[model samples]
Target: MDLFTLTVVNAFIALVATGVLAMQGQADRQFRYQRYFLLAGGCMLLNAGISAIHFSGILLPYWLIPALTNSLSVGASLALAAGIHRHLQKPGKRFGLLLVFILLFVLHLTEFARSDINHRFLISIPVVLLLNLWCISMLWQHRKTELGKVYLAFIATFAFNILQFVFRTTFMVLEQHQIIQTSIAPVVHNVGFFALTAFAILVFCCIILLSHSQQRQMLQQLSERDALTGLLNRRTLELRLNAEFSRCQRNNSTLCLLLLDADYFKQINDKLGHATGDLAVQHIAKIADQQLRDYDLLFRYGGEEFLLCLPDTDLPAALQIAERLRLAINSAPLFTPQPYFLTVSIGVASSKDSQSWQTLLQQADQALYLAKHQGRNQVQSYQPTAAVSR
Candidate 1:
């Protein structure tokens, strides 16, 4: 097609690639393989960008055009091939395949150095065909798996590239033979190539949307979750608490925040070092996680401090839970090689009347502070209207 049309198509493909990369953020290892496919497809389209200049002010040579375009296409093909092997769970072969592609690239460049365009095309197309065949083979071998879906996706991708290659080759051969004004040019190649690019662009767009959707999901998960403990962070707790509070107010359901702090944490760090201390916290978090309901949100408020937002729970019930957790921590031995014992202090705060999530947190903190002041391993519950907001 014309340069303007080609440039627009390539630009569109580039955007699709970006979208695909973004979406891969939360994908499992297998599904994430599609990222490479879109990446390769994007690279191939970039080659068209060199010739499809919209600016009339710029000039480019015919020889430079085909050569650069061919390079990008080959490069893209190689990336896709490597991605296929990864999806197929044959990663050991990827390095070898990559090396082979590098050699082919070297051979193609050498042919170019010698001004042999035919040999360059000859060397490149077979590599692409082989790459696609390998992908198809991998898919066929794993036809019974959930991974089959990935293979089918690859098949569609391979067909698109093969079709694009055929159309491009036809036009190049015809143009080189001085057949520009022939009816076959418009009917068989020009319009046909444009249509194929459009089809390929659509395929690319689908992949991009898939990837972009994943990235957004991953970001959302990261926002609400603590990386180490797999618990809701402080920000997420506030949001969940607000929503829970509104629901509780409407239904007259009770809710509470249980604040827990590990006792003698600094001593653990000083004696066992930070690594063991981290493991201790991790162990306690695991124990706490096992004890909590799925609806409950746990937050690491800061160093050695955790908060649990309990919906539909009254102050008495919250205190019972706090006591249970306190006993659980105190009874459990240190889950490390170093000889030691660890305990935790827990504070429970229930809403007296209407209160914000912040007010509940302040009350819980006050109770926890009291526990620390009294001793180490103990559970303290805040009576309604017992103290002013700290």
Candidate 2:
């Protein structure tokens, strides 16, 4: 296609992308990255519009067109980088990136207008190259996750764009040296230009896919998590316990279970109101989370109660962990409407003594009962003969 046609096509695509992304952002407020996507689309639209007007022999100042177009291109690139960061759930410093882009665009715009097309390409190259490289690095860091796998498309696209820029630079140099005498030597005539357009379309599709994936994840979390504490709910606990139980039995590996309940939780709810009571429950979940190892699984079994699954742990080790959890809860006072101290009674049971997870849970519950009976804020272990309070 000719330059005018390509520019118009690009402008149409950019406008379409902007509309799609804006609608997506409106539909799903959780994926804030869609806003950056919209920003990128808008910038690309502006860039294409300005390019078309300049190419149409409009009576604008010769320098002004390329300057605005290139600045918008830089803005689009930076917005893409910011979008990728937010998509990965990473902290994106948009203000800092915007500041840097503004400085670089100002520095490049004047010189870019005065210089030839090759110099303009050179000036724009580093800005885009650096931004694309930054995005590639961010995606690479999260390569192990499911979302990261989707990011590979982004990597390929950016890398292709960067490689295309490199080739365009070389072609520009050859043209400058009069090594090749061809009319179609500019970037608009290159194969890479079309490829970049195709990749831009692919990126929009990928962002839609990313949003779908995140939405599915959110739904899964809602189904499996406790609404108040944001810990695994009882349904999730049952599934995990069954899986862990089978695995332990097959491998002859030890596993431990602990059932913990917040002491005087009902009293707190009655005296301090449900709002403070909710905070107290959240506090227990937080403390328990901090005390456990990465391999340990913590679940909110029900209201004011939690269940923990510790793989490869024996009775003695489980007891120690339970005691540590109890003490940790006792040490930190929860911030309610008023400061209030909280305690938890924990029960420990090991897979070595029980044939099945149900048996283990039953034993743990019994031990938990004993701990609550023998004054709260204690860890108790299950004995086959009787519950032993520790």
Please provide TM-scores, in order, for all candidate models, with all chains considered together: 0.51, 0.90
Off by over 4 Å in 1: 1-203, 352-354, 384-390
Top TM-score prediction, candidate number:
2
Residue 5 accuracy (lDDT) in model 2: 71
Find the number of clashing residue pairs for candidate 2. 0
Write candidate 2's Cα lDDT for 1-390 as tens digits.
677777877889888988988998999997788898889889888888887776776766644567667778888888999888887778646788788667756765575546777676766778889999999999888877867767887788788878877877687788789888767675436465576577678778777877888888899989998889888999888789999999989888999999999988899999989998888889999999999999899999878999999998888998999998898999898876567889889988999888889999999999899888889789988878884555
Model 2: lDDT to the true structure: 0.84
Give me the candidate number with maximum lDDT.
2
lDDT for position 131 in model 2: 93
lDDT of 1 by residue, 233-346 (tens): 877776788898888878888889889999989998997899887888787888898789988878888878898889999988989888888888777788567556778999
